[model samples]
Each structure stands twice: as structure tokens, then as C-alpha cells.
Target: MNLDREVIKALAPTGVLRASINLGNPILANTSKSTGEPEGVSIDLARAFAQHLGVDVELVVFDAAGRSVQAVASEQADIGFFAIDPVRGAEIAFSAAYVLIEGSYLVREESPLLHNDEVDRDGCLVAVGKGSAYDLFLTRELKHAHIVRAPTSPTVVQTFLEQELDVAAGVKQQLESDCRKHAGLRLLPGRFMVIRQAMGVPKTRGAGAARALHAFVEEMKDSGSVADALQRHSIEGASVAPNEA
Candidate 1:
């Protein structure tokens, strides 16, 4: 299956399908060990899309989601795989969601913030990956918490290791990975947001390309290959219902 040929032909000559990584989540990291090749749910899904489309997966690593979306919106990349937000949806064309995510908070086991409701209540210092979906969501939804945006998930994890902030927040998968790296860190039970992860295509691209890609994803979901890929990479908490998308 010559994926590149098919994807290029489908994309037309003017477009380059681009996929970037939001360095905020280990499971979604371009360098994650689970898949042994920057494998994660998003990476596997994107690769599968590329394979099914007969295109080469052009993987781009971005420090944050803001830059990633910009790549898609500016037509630098034809599509992106990441957590979907209503605000981001307004900027780019999003396909039907392929996965569901729960936002979570990470804290040190002994930190006062672990027990103090007031810390989570209002104006508390919470760390987040800068320019990430969590950053946007935190700023918009967490009115009571003062956000300290870290440049990357590692930075956020490092800060949490140092006990410099009360809590760090991001997707549950990321928080779980962080907890593994830092023994003292633990994830809180509640979710901050429920995210529907999807693919983003530039609005500048022809509608047909978006529709084609959407159909390809739908087919992958229907085939059960998507769930197989996620399980192969050991990605937990991502619900893959056959043909659900």
C-alpha cells in the first residue's frame, strides 16, 4: 500500500499533511517508549491514518499545542492530532472525535495542596504546560487557581518534584506518566475537563480533503485497528468503541 502516493494525490499538490506532538503528555509524546517509535494513542492513530491514506507520516514535534494548531491553521500542515477544544475548533476544522480524555491534577503526596480544599478553591498556584490545551482550559475554566505555565510537561513535572507549586494539571495520561517518573507525585480523583481528541485540518484546504480524511478515520474506527494500536502501545483510559466515531 503506497500510502504516500494516495495521501499526496488526495491532498493535492499544494497541501502537506502535518502532524505535531504536544510535549505535555508522555503517552502522546513523540518520544514515548510504549510504542518504541514515539508511539502513543495519537501517534498510532495518525500513523494509521497515513498508512490507510497511502501517505508518509510527516511527524513534527512542537513544544506546545498553540504552535501545533498554528501549523494547521496557517496551512503549514494539513492536519494535526491532538485534544480538541471548542476554542481550537473555531480556529481549525476538526474531524469527529476519536478518543475521550479526562483532565487531572497532579500533586506531591505530602503537599498541603493535597488536602487543602482552599488551595484548589481559589487563587492557588497551579502549574501547567504553556500553550497547551490544559493551559487554555485552566485559564478559561479554573477561575480560582492562579496558573503558572511551564514550557513543557517535563518542566511541570520537575516543578512538582521540587515542590515549587501546589499542583500541576494536564491530561490524565500525562499525569499518570508523571506519577511513574516522580514517585512523590499523585493524581487527584476529579477531572478538570472532558476532552474529545480528534484530527485538525486547515480551513484553507479544500473541503474534500477534510472529508476524505474524516472518512478514512471513520473506517479505521470501524475496523478495530484503532483499538488494537492503542492496546499495542499500552495507552490506558482511552476508550475506543468500534465504529463509534
Candidate 2:
């Protein structure tokens, strides 16, 4: 593989790759309790990309997807991992996803909501991480329910419990973990959406960097690096995304 110095410089102007890590999504990243470093599939991918570039990585950590998106949009971080969303696409050039994760809802066991389709009824208060893909999707698709924005996806379950929300929408793995941690919480039978987890660079980084990042993701997917990262990180409920045309 040939390195494009011009594209590398555009994407990593600081001479090092700055990757924004969103700790709010446990499926992708979290603070390791023992090492206190960001550890997950996202971190692994970041390091791999830096290695490919023959550069070092600096992780700009945030507690939510919104903040990570803000970091790249403001050029504070050269690149970020994010869900593919049209709203964010306006400011960021997204690669095809290397992983796919399910988005689902969680409710108190005794709640009347028994299915995914039942969550959109009137009087249902859905709690979601602000600026999350689920929040954006629900904002557009929900007809009757009022959405309560939480600080982040990791906190949405706690907010739902505290606020007595009718539903908590987030990554299925996260909701499942919450259910196990706290009794009387149950995930809906099925998923509401499938999140396409992709890496993005600021649109201002130019087309050259965008093309490079896109190819990088596709190569990783095809070479099994993405799947290897997922297994090495002990990730569950995520699978390598299919190659895109």
C-alpha cells in the first residue's frame, strides 16, 4: 500500500492522528477499569489506522456521540467513529461502516410495551442520548411519543429509571447489560434500527483524505482486521459490516 503524504497531512495536520473516542457507547468504547485507557473495537481500529500511517495516535475522549461528532466537525480531532446519519453527513465525510450494531429499546418489566412497534404510542416518554442515531431517527419517525434527551447513551438507562420514562432507546448490547445489572428492566423483543458504525473525517479535510479514509475502511473490512479487532476486544452483538459497492 502506498502512503499519500498529502492526504495524510490533510487528515492529520498536527503530525499525529487525533481520533475521537466516544465512551458513551460501550459496544464500541469504554474506559478500561484496570488500565484506565480507552479500550474497545474503536480504539483498536484507531491504533491500527495510526500504525498504517506510520504515525502516533492521540485519542480525544468524549462521553457521548454528540461530543465526538462535534470534535471532528470543529477539527479538534482529525477523525471520529460515528453512526452513519444524514444530519452528520452534512459536515463529515463518512466511510462505509466496518461494523453493524443493533439499536433497541428497554422498558421496565412491568411496562405495557411488549414489542418494538408498541413504543411509539401517545403518552410514551422515550429517553435517548442527545444527538444519537436513535434520537435522530426517533425525532424523524416518532409521531406521538415525546423524546427526552439524556447526556449520553450510557446514562440513558439510568435516566429512564430515575425519570420513570416509558422507554430507553440505545444500543441493544447496552440495554441488555443494563437489564442484567438491574432487575425488572427488559429489552424489547426486536431492534428498532441497525446502526452503521463508520469512521469519519471533517468535510474540510478535503476529498483526498476522505477517499483515503474510505478505502482504508473497506480494506480493513475485507482483510478481516475489523472482525479481528472485535474478537480481540471481547465485543459482543456486533458483526463485520458487509462490503459496499
Q: Which candidate tops TM-score? A: 2
Which residues of candidate 2, in runs, are more than 4 Å off? none
Listed in order, each prediction's TM-score against the native is 0.82, 0.98
Candidate 1 displacement at residue 191 in angstroms: 2.0
lDDT tens readout by residue for model 2, 49-79: 8888788999999999999999999999999
lDDT of each: 0.69, 0.92
lDDT of 1 by residue, 80-137 (tens): 8767777777767777777677778888787665442445566568888777778887
Off by over 4 Å in 1: 1-16, 32-37, 112-120, 161-163, 241-245
Candidate 1 residue pairs in clash (backbone atoms < 3 Å): 3-54, 3-55, 4-54, 4-55, 123-144
Worst 10 residues of 2 by lDDT: 1-10
